[model samples]
Target: MGKKEILVVDDQPGIRMLLTEIFTSQGYRVTTAETGQEALDSLYAGSFDLLMLHYKLPVVDGVQVLEQLEKDQFTIPAIVMSGLSEDIMKESQQFEIVKEVLAKPFNVEEVCEFTRSILE
Candidate 1:
């Protein structure tokens, strides 16, 4: 099979860069979006194996993006990241596409492992 494709969406440039570099190094095709609209555009533009998203973002938050996609009936698997309290995390998981939630301080290794765990 071809390399798995991952769409990494985060408002922070550093996080986007880090995930892009880490996943690229692991032989995954990675794309990034700084906003929810860009993320949805990317989703429509390609067939990605997984979506790695940040819950908090500028102009249409992550939950709204996920909800909208779900409303449109896209079954893309997703991994959401957030620094908020655990209660918010619990609340965010109501979306069916959210297969995993990673806290803000997660390491690159954890991200890699989690991605493989889901996609493999």
Candidate 2:
């Protein structure tokens, strides 16, 4: 089988770089996108095993991206990260496709572990 591919979408370059390094170091094929539309475009162009998305993405929010993906029948797993409160996370959980909700200021190891757990 080929290397697992992961898409990391965030508006911040620093965050995208950090995630790219983390996933690439773990032997995963990594792709970075700065906006939700870019993420969707990337998704349409290639296959990915998972998506790591920032909740407050520009052009389209994480939920919107997930919705679009579902509408298009793409079933890849997703991890949504946000600095929002627990209440907001709970609200977002109404979306069935979200595999996990990660709070901001999270540990890098935790993110890697979650991604590994889901993909592996």
For TM-score, the strongest prediction is 1
State the C-alpha lDDT per candidate.
Answer: 0.90, 0.88
Which residues of candidate 2, in runs, are more than 4 Å off? none
lDDT of 2 at 98: 79
Per-residue error for 89 in candidate 1, Å, reads 2.3
In model 1, the Cα lDDT at residue 73 comes to 94
Angstrom error at residue 1, model 2: 1.2
TM-score of each: 0.95, 0.94
Prediction 1 global C-alpha lDDT: 0.90
